[model samples]
Each structure stands twice: as structure tokens, then as C-alpha cells.
Target: MSRFLYLDNAATTKTAPEVLEAMLPYFTEKFGNPSSVYQFAAENKTVVDEMRKIIAESLGAKSKEIYFTAGGSEADNWALKATAEAYQAKGRHIITTKIEHHAILHTAEYLERQGYEVTYLDVDEDGKVDLEELKAAIRPDTILISVMYANNEIGTVEPIREIGEIAHEHGILFHTDAVQAYGHLPINVDECYIDMLSASGHKLNGPKGIGFLYIRTGVKIRSFIHGGAQERKRRAGTENVPGIVGMGAAVKRAFDTMEERTAREKEVRDYLIRRVENEIPYCRLNGHRTDRLPNNANFSFQFIEGESLLIRLDMKGICASSGSACTSGSLDPSHVLLAIGLPHEIAHGSLRLTINEEISKEDVDYVVDSLKEIVEGLRNMSPLYEDFVKKQEKNV
Candidate 1:
């Protein structure tokens, strides 16, 4: 078997060593409840506060603004449901993109059953929400707009600032699922006029099951969880002390090295794009050329199933993904690809390779070379391609 090449960083990244080091003590030496009033607990409490402070500072927010949760899904859930329930008096109408992660989309659906109205804004061919559609969606009843900062499958970044302005102009709250964009891209809640932002730690080389939601100072939201006095009584349950510590360390390390990391990742991403286009036949990139995530490279083969391509790459010890593994079991093409105006066949043939900050040129070259072969083999078996060829030949 060949050595594995992990390129699925978007799904999750290996926890950084520095982050692990920071979290170690919390699990053993300093394992005390942050709420405990004893001297022993005071030590851990101080650490949690520092973690909150640094994370908040990195996002240009106040320490109290950052509330930890169990990864992006929970944060997204809390942001939408909490705000909807609290602001139901104002209106039951909400706006979000059709391509939002299930965390937000499903929650919005659940809200509909509970008598809330939701307007799902459509995106353009590049997977960007149409600002005009968003503007038109707003009404006197509009209460909130929850658009993602960047797409998970296609990697297209949204016009969050514009969306925020639109929401505010209509007297509505704006939330962004920044799970994929927070650490990789600089995000200031104030700059984007963001009322709420969700970020996951594992996406930035921190411990899994730890995430934070940035709630603007005056944003009105009710608690979904109950029982504890934790999270300023906003969220309940015991604090994930070690996970919180690790997340802070990871956030600090990420932004500290952001520029260098961004440049390298972008270079590799563009190189992969160039190589696949320059080397493979009938390949088309799935997202915006320059308006996508720095580490995301998604493409569609002319006539191949994404699942089959994923397995081929996997057998070669190349860890890539077709779409979000969270939605892999579903035979339906990614809603993102479909929303971007891609034909069903094209959407089904998509491949996503999200790279690490450290993947070298050679690794990408190998993957590109392997892809060229795999796609050719897959295309050979494709009756559609064969028919296309025959039709072209007859026309000639």
C-alpha cells in the first residue's frame, strides 16, 4: 500500500501539536470545573477566560461575546433557533441561502414546522447569493438573515458584508456560519456588521467537538440549552475545558501564521487547478476562480461518478472527498453544485480536494497525475462520452 496523502482538510484537520500541548494540563493537572469556587477551580477558570479573550480578540470581538459550544453545528443551531424564538414577536420571517450547511438549513426547516416563515435566497452560477434576491426577500416581517461566509462543498465565499447591510437596513439580525472561513480568512464581526458568527475548532487544527459563536453585544437570543449557569446562562452543560484551551491555542497559532499559510495554500490550490486543467481533458472547476476558499479545489470530470472517483483516490492512499462526507450517503448531488446551475450529471461528477497548509507541490502533482489516469479510465466506461464522441464524429 502507498503512503496516505491527506487532502481532505475541509472535513477536519489533525489537531496541531501546539494546541495539544496547551490542552494537556487541563485534562489532568488542572482538571477542575470552571464554575467551582475553590482555589483549584480558579486556575482553570482563569485559563478559560484567557482562551475566550484571545479568541475574541482574534475576531475583533469582546471576550464576553465569544461563547463556546459543541462544534459548528451546535453553534449554528443556537444562533438561528435562539434568535428566531426570541424575535418571534418582531416577526417569524427569516432569510438564508439555499446552499447553507445542513446545520443551518435543517434548523430553518424545523423552524417552519413551528410556524416560522423562511425565505431561501438563491445563488448565482458561481455559488454566490444574489444580493437582489436577498433585498427582495426582506419584508416588514423579516427578523433575521443567516448566510454562510463560505461554502463547504464549492468553497465560494459569499458577499457577507452586503448581506449584513441588507439585513440591518430592514431591521433584521444577520448571522453567518463562518465555520470554514473564520480562521482561514480574517473575519471581524464589526467589519461585516455580523450579529452572529459560528466557527469550529477542528477546522483550524484544534480539538474536535469545540466551537464558538460570536454574539454581538446587543443581539437578542434565547438559550436553547438549560440547567447550568455556564455560558452566561446562554448555553448549559459543563465546559469542554481542554477543548476550549486547545481551540484558543489553535486560533492564536492560525492567525499568527495566517499570511504565510494563506499564500502557501493558495499557491497549491491554484497549482492544482492549473495542473488539472492543463493535463486532464474535459475538466471544469466547480467554484469561482478567484472568489473561493484558499485551500479548496473542486472540479468535475466529464463523465465519472464522484463516489467512484473518491474510491479510486482512496485506494491510492490519496485522501480526498467528492462532497461533504456528512452528506455522502445521499445519492442526490450536492445541493450547492445544483444551486450553482450545474446540470445534474455534472454535479454528480464533482470532486473536492481541500488541502492542508503544508501539502507540497509534488503531492499535488502526484494526485493530478493520478486523477488524469482515473478520469480517463472512468470516462472510457461512460456511455455518455462514447455517444458524445460518436455524435461529434458523425457531424464531422
Candidate 2:
């Protein structure tokens, strides 16, 4: 393709040049195992410690609270499973929302199989968890409340502070999967009363397969992996020195430019949303319009299949998504859309476009222009659209 435009930042981001530069030395000349007693090797351990401090400071957490993991999924799994196991004596009930990432949902399901009672709370039409409903869901046996900071598919930012308040009032632990919000949104673990939070480097322009979980001191969670004394004897493995360096660089860069970069992304994102809403027919915007991630814009066209729309967009050299990258291979409609009360047919027609600092107004224009023509063409060929048109003609 002569021209390519990427609008799927939520799925993954391009690694920054600075981040790569920071990581290269670890793979070649500085290839030293952190656990080794030699000074050269143990110096690499200092690099890991420096990165932990960087990540911890960004979240207003102490350095010791951060534990590195392979990625967000592992961090999430560790948070849920270990917390459940650690606190089972106190309670076996957990609370989460219906629109969580599959990492959380599937883990919760597994917990259910193991004799834990999980209550999947519902959301409104805009994919916002109802605080009243959350309050009502709590019981004496509820040990934990896990919620995502934002919906990856729909872009709805949940009321995390409010949820945390509720959880704390009831003496329950609060864990948030902040994979989509860690760099994109400003978060303070202390200010939000967050007991545990998960974040992945790949979501913020770092290398893949590195993430961290921040556990409040004295939480008493068990070790997720058992072998060596890595990650403060909580998670066991050889330290990923290069990935840690890359993530530290990425996090620093993101935090340094967050205000300016997010402002630009939000402008482009809103422009795209307005153009699509004005030009596209029989479509609805998904998620809370104002209380959403700065770069996410999702829509559901009435009569077009999302996968077909995705294929056509790809042909035009545009990179977008129907939903979460994790579940793209599945033919099932998005659970987030269903949680928002959309019918199965409408949910099947969804599209998600997440922009980044690199996206421009002209790029959004090209995408919208391409979408207008593609949606019209797809609708013309759809039997469902044809039936509706015929019915309308008869009424006319």
C-alpha cells in the first residue's frame, strides 16, 4: 500500500524511538542477569529498580508496591486469583462489572468454578457502571471489587474513585485493570483509593510482554509464580531487563508529553466523531460522549456487518478494529455492546477507532470519507437494509 493510516492505538502502539534506544544495550553489550552476584550482572538489577521507581511514581505508589509481570493479563490474573486465595478466609464473594476485559471476565469465571461467588453488575446504555447497583450488589461476604478503568471496546471511563469509595466503605479490596488508562489517563493510586492496579507497556508505546501490578502494602496476597526470589519474592522469574528499560522509557515519555499529546488526540478524535455522526446514516455513537478515553471513537452502523466493514477499511489502507484485538478472531458480537443494551444485530455492526498523537485531521478526513462511501455501498447490498427501504417506500 502506498499510503497507510493507523487508528487502532488501543490494540497496541508503535514503540517510541527513545524507548528502543534505551532498551538496545540490555540485549547486547549489557546482557547481564540481574540475579548474578557479579557487579556487572547485578548492575542490571539497579536498572530494574530504577524502572520500578519510575512506574511507581507515575501512579503515586511507593516503589516497593510495584511488581513486574509478563503483561497485563498476567498482572490481572495475579491480582484476582491471588487476592481471592489470600482473602478466602474473610470472604469468597467478589464484585465486578459485566463489561470487563475477557482477562478479568474469564478469570472471574474460573473463580466461580472454584467455589467463589461473583456478581457481574450491569451498566447503562452508555456502558457506565451504576453506582447504586454497585452499592446494592455488595454483601457481607464480598472480599474484592474489580473494575476496569475504562472500557477498551466502547471507551467508557468508569467512575473508579466512586467505586473505590464504595468498596472501601464496606472494607473490601479494590483492584482496577488500568491497561487502557495507565498512560492515557492521569491516575493516583492514593487519590483513587486503588488497592491494586494493572498496566501493560505495549498499551503506551513500549515493547510487548512487560507489565506491572501495584499492590498496596500489607495486602497479604500470595505469590503468583513460584521459583526464584524475583519481584520481591512475589513473582518468580528471570527479570526481563530490556523490556523493563523500554517500559520505563516509554512511561517517562508518555508522562512528560501526556498533557499536550492527549489534547491533540482528543481534538482529532472529536473531529472524527463529528464527521462520522454527521455524514453516516443509520448509525449510533457508542459510549459516554464526554466521559471517555481521549482517543476512542466507536460507532454501530445499523445494517452493515462489522467484519465486512473492517475488511473494506483495510483495503483502503486504514487500520481499525471491530472490537478488542483479543477477540477479533471470534465471530461473536462484543460483550461490551451487549452490556449497553444494544440488540444483537446492531452490536454486530460496531466499529472502534482509537487515535494516537500521530493521527492528524487530514487522516481522520480520509478515514471518514472512505467510511461514508463504504457504508453506503455495504448498506445497498444488504438484504436487511433493502427490506427496510421497501417498507418505508410502501408507507410513503
- Return the top candidate by TM-score: 2
Q: Among all windows of ten consecutive residues in candidate 1, which has the lowest summed lDDT?
A: 162-171
Residue 252 local lDDT, model 2? 98
Which lDDT tens digits does candidate 1 get at residues 1-396?
A: 576899999999999999999999988988999999999998888889999999999989999999999999999999989998899988999999889999999999999999999999889888988899888888898888999999999899998888888777777899999999978998888888899999999999999999999999988897878989899999898899999999999999999999999999999999999999899978889888899999999998877899999998898889988788689799999898888888999888999999988899999988988988889999899999999889989999
Candidate 1: C-alpha RMSD after superposition: 0.9
The deviation in Å at residue 60 for candidate 1 is 0.8
Q: After superposition, how far is residue 13 of candidate 2 from its true place, in Å?
A: 0.7
Q: Per-residue error at 122 for model 1, in Å? A: 0.8
For every candidate, C-alpha RMSD to the true structure in Å? 0.9, 0.7
Badly placed stretches (over 4 Å) of model 1 are: none
Best by lDDT: 2
The TM-score values for the models, in the order shown, are 0.99, 0.99
Could you give me the TM-score of model 1 versus the true structure? Answer: 0.99
Clashes of each: 0, 0
